[model samples]
Target: MSTIILVIGYAISCTKNDQVIIPDAGASSTTLVSVNTSTPPTIDGSIDALWNSATKISITPTVPDPGNGLFTGYIGEQYAGTLRSMYDAQNIYFLLEVTDASQSTNVTPWYFDPTANVAGKTGWAKEPSSKTYDVNGNLIRAAWGEDKFAMLWNIDNSTPKFAAQTCYASCHVFTPYLDYSGVLASPQTATTPPTVSNSGSGNHYTNGPNEKIDMWWGRLGYITKDASLNLMDDNYQDYAGGQAITNLTGGNANGRHVDGIVPDGTKSTIWPYRPNYTVSPTQGEVGNTQNLKLDGTGASVAVPLWVIPNAGSANFILVSDTTSGKAKKVTAVSSAGVLTLSDGSTINPTVGTDYQRTGDAVNGPTAKNSIPANIAVPLIGGRADITCAATYTGTGWIIEYKRALKTGDVLKQDIDFSSLQDQVFGVAFWNKSNNQHGIQPNLTLTFKK
Candidate 1:
């Protein structure tokens, strides 16, 4: 039978029933107390009044050694942040503030290319790199990647090494030649791809079965506060065995998986305006007929699916403009097969140039701040348990979120805090790149008596 999970508002209470949730583990040394609150803070990005008196925890993340010769290539500035927690009878709320020089919103976004055809999408371009790498082949910064934060909670003490290793417990690095499990009879290289059956280089899998960790992932560029969905991808990690690769694509295998069924079944079909992203034909106003335009020679050529109308003040749309619904997107085409903007202006094709939003001027027609690569959609099912909001203040980011104290998920996808027992968890921050991140492990969480 399908379980019914209630969606509670910021003012409503979703307390734990009379059920007792007993964990199979013990406590740690350092503790971050979750103080009691008669008045809970709102989950908006703004700092609320009740947060002034709550206990806070310092979070300073640093790059971790993955143990192999493989390097994260991250040479970006390291910054520290603060974490605050509070709880009432029904829900637990969190406030996270971190320092960052730049607000990276875009990942890999599509652009209008006049002379290229990728995967049958003719005249389209996508940024491959930020070109900000150092001489040592280390990634100096993520000029094109988004800013992100994540937390992993130990589930029922299933992972014994969690308090000590934290994120490392679920992470395994593979060499270019050797496999951890010795499952493959032969060695593999960068050219030879590694599958679950074979191992070469990659990580993020649990050591054994039944070892589960609940993950709360927040992407600054992907934060959505709409009713259809919110930000924060509710994911989890379990055993996929040693030598298994991290699952970038959605699924239950390869360790990391979303909270609901396989393939992100609860993911929203529509996209929100906040955390603005490049629109596509399927999800936005662009249509299939607008894919191509007639050139001066009367030959059909490819065109962009979307563009910012009257892009005068800025080369690209800003996050603030999207939130206010001022970022105009024009998808209508002219009778002569030319692209038209909302202001009735036509986009003339320019060879050897592309309309792109990126950090690199060489790869962009008009360089500006980055645009979001993904749209914000609410996650349904078990994945929709958490509600969140985030804001970037030019210098850093402020994120606020909340979840029910107890969510009776039959799939064991969540940890129950009704018992108020101390639990161990690990938090991480990703400045730009994906693999390179700072992790603070073995953090003990306890409720104030």
Candidate 2:
């Protein structure tokens, strides 16, 4: 039976005894905190077990009717199979099994005749020898020669694997060799041939390198490429059309010269091919602002933190004298991109300078100046590190301040503050301490509203 996991959100109110207390208010109770209970899924299994339970598919080679001396050995027939599995964590595993029972006896090798001056032929082309099958006898090769094979996967499917009415090995369209081998009397005996290395050498596999192949291999659970190409790791010119062999020969044959080995004790020659890529998160970055409503239900009071642009602003504010107590009211005039006070005094809004807002009298006849709400009192050159005290409750922030009154009273102003780009103002009652008692007084502060 399959197990289905259900996740539920529950709020818990715990007392000093470590026991959960469910309030009578149900889920609407703000005194409780909700918690989610769910674990991420994963996959666990051995490589062999994974391979056996995966989906398996076969790829084979096709035989030409008018036997081209090209695929001669045992009629150039072979098949390969691949197995794929997906783990619980969505990780994908691929195991390729190749079978070439004919082995060396069924090998047919050919090279492109560079001097042949064929219009489009530029590299080595191999044509396998013909094969004759007896009614009740084993397959026999009418001729014998060296053989090489390469398998291609449609990892990206950018290009057609095989052209119509043509075996992939017939047209010599996809050459995995870097340097076309010139016609020679005998084939090279070295295990490593002089042909360009498809896996490296920066030649045949120009589009898909080993590094790209590995990345796609790991990300298979989350992504998939269109097509893949498998070429013989060795330098032999035996190319196969894979599972689409019939597509290449106009329905003449159903498969190509590919083999599938279950990858036992031997290392498989197949390599995944893919293009270079960069991974980016689908959700992107987080934003800095939240919505606020005026219905008294949204975040009303919030600490204002201004990010100053430069050091000049910082120095200007740092040198300002906050203890002066005396306030100044001056008119700010801007012209020709320059700012100056009405007193004919010019102040540079650079770092280390203190800016004061000026306006009409604030409270009584004794006050000659007051900070105006329309005036900007900016501390210039302050770095972007400006920070103010704020209370964050997941959804909002609150800013707090105190108010002073002439009645020798002090009170707190709890205004729903928004952004620093605008002015703010509020009123509250202040409490004063008398010689032997405390008194309350009406108080108000008028600055940048």
Candidate 3:
């Protein structure tokens, strides 16, 4: 809800007929209402007065002119279009008038369509009657209309400028009121200085005497100064000997340009320019996996699950834990449906022995010493002990054990081994404590060479 007020550069008329009007000089006759809340009371006169006063201060002459030729060139370049200043404020209404005689000859009143976009398209463009020239032949741009006007203050300068092409007017408006304290000022003058109300104490225009117009022009790679308002040489140069006039035309058109109204009422573009101030919300990386802490209740947080590369083939695998945390490898599955792991090893589960038996249970050779020379049991028996001992592990479980066979030995058992050959297999672990507890550990098994 805080307000920001920016002092955009002023448009000085070349001709006296183009003079800007100040509000009638008298104590406000109507009851002044606070603009802080929704559905603020109507006080048109006070709003207009405050707006005019703020505009006057923004246009007040700060530094001496840089001679007529340079000033004219600056205006000519600025006429092409240049962003002057940007600020935010509360309920105070602000207007920017661009008198383009070439574009409009009659009373060209500035009007703005404050409506936002719909379906990703601007509603203003659809409103046929949104733009019109006023009776004075000046291009008038107003911010809000009716109840929607309240949303105007909520707008940051960039959105309005970028979305609705508000930059076409070349003038920016700031509202509420800003304190000019600590801002450099011209010496006390015969003409009464403009009075500024300190309503929004912290709010001030981004560009001010402390931040000279020259500094902005330099940033924009172009220079600008008023030629008609020059003081003596003593007043023209700063103590550092740097001329007050700024050169914005850095001699490059590398940056995009926007249009602005010149003092001569001409439409011109300001090239390679940047705004005096900007505000941006915090943003996060696209593929960040860090846990995002949420603030306040009912707030939702989103994290990216996976990324699909634009090229190559797409396949789904269990999310990798190793490479995800450190150096992990996404097991590559070959076109033959073989799962290849980083280390070379082939896994093919046995059918009758490796798999669980469903039918009648096999009574063990009751005693290891009283075993028959050769034992015979149904292939589909409920369960058979493949190894003499219940459990023994080296690389994999010993399904059928032999005392003389060494590790890595390929020993074939004659009990229907064909049913298990070439069958793909996967390993799964269960937490013995809980039947429901199971986990797929970081294991990648590949077929042997």
Candidate 4:
């Protein structure tokens, strides 16, 4: 975070204490719609009775804050987004939709620079690629960074006018601990910087250096961080830039911990989650229920091997030769024998992106085809308190997140949603894997019975 930039201007807080990020864009201030439904909305991103009728708040692009020196806004009016909010008596929900042209999940866990002889290096340009340099930086140097989203909630509404001036209260260029080698860079220091000089930058909470802001980070790395499970990470931004307290099942703080170059990296670190066709029978390809077309231009012909797990979940990954080890998630697992990949393509693992690995009788860590898919121990606690699901409809992605209104587990970093008071929150979206994100600050979610 030590990317020093000369601050050309400074921003003064002028927004009202009651401001809402998406107010009357045509819709009224009833942005937080409460629905007391006994039937929980399916965590599947589809427009259902659970969330379809809820008010859809249009999210416009957030212009760059010239006053903020770390300003890096890549979304230049290119994409627009929408959001939906709903809550039952026990939980709060948010569905965010963002327009993205492509999906990029090449996080540090999944990045492989084989020619340069590094196994789990990052996507940065410093990595050797036989002929060129891996330039995404030791921490990050990839144009196609991981796809992600985040939600920021004002803790205890402590900052004055947090309900209205949500994020602005904390944007004072306060850096969190990102030092990979410094002895002082412990997780505790990473969560709350020990001093003003070593904090690094970008954390703007000035009044109270220890002021906590609830931040939910949905990095694509987490989705496949585990070979068999799906996850989204949770962290908070305070004195330190951003720190995640826990990882999802099968998730880790840093995928490249084997080498300590990026030791400070969090689970949100840019890494890829390669596919493991051998883990379960129905894991990668389920008998090629539908036939797919292949590129047919490879030097060596590719093969597809259908596998089934011991007790596989309803989820499946789409392995394709064209996309290297990129695995797309296929939710519909019809037992009828015919497989429909996430794309409208058939299940015959011979299509452009319909490829699979085949080495051992079953695909696991030892499977020849999936030799690189290192299966590590999942995260502790798994942060089950926060659950989210998303579906991408061609132009954009629709995401749904659900969490209990009360925090009980100290391990999960759960929120204390106990009282009926209103809370302040902010949302951000990543488009097509760019490092820059579109952010909306100071959103209010009023909890009422």
The CA lDDT of each predicted structure is 0.53, 0.19, 0.17, 0.39
- Expressed as tens digits, the lDDT of each residue in 209-311 for candidate 1 is 7788788877665563243434576767766533322221111124666675332223223211011112222221112123443333334444433455434
lDDT-best of 1 and 3: 1
**lDDT winner between candidates 3 and 4:** 4
lDDT of 3 at 396: 17
State which candidate has the highest lDDT: 1
What lDDT score goes with residue 277 in model 2?
23
Assess every candidate by TM-score.
Answer: 0.66, 0.19, 0.16, 0.51
**Of 2 and 3, which scores higher on TM-score?**
2
- For model 3, give the 10-residue run with minimal summed lDDT: 215-224
Candidate 2 all-Cα RMSD: 38.4
Question: Model 3 off-target regions past 4 Å?
Answer: 1-21, 29-124, 128-131, 134-279, 282-449
Regions more than 4 Å wrong, model 4 = 1-30, 61-63, 66-79, 108-142, 174-201, 204-206, 224-229, 239-379, 410-414, 447-449
lDDT of 1 at 188: 37
For model 1, where is the 10-residue window of minimal lDDT? Answer: 1-10
Candidates sorted by lDDT, descending order? 1, 4, 2, 3
Cα deviation of 67, candidate 1, in Å: 5.5
lDDT for model 2 comes to 0.19
Residue 75 CA displacement from its true place in model 2, Å: 2.3
lDDT of 3 by residue, 1-449 (tens): 00111111122111111111221212121112112222322221112233322211111111112122112211211111001111122222222221111211011111112232122221111111112235774433211110000000101122222122111111111122222333423223214443444221111111222211100100000000111111101000001111111112211111111111111322223322222212122211112122221221222222112222111111111123224542122133222212223444321112122111222222111111110111111111111111111111211111111111111212111111111112111111111110110111111111111
Candidate 4 accuracy as TM-score: 0.51
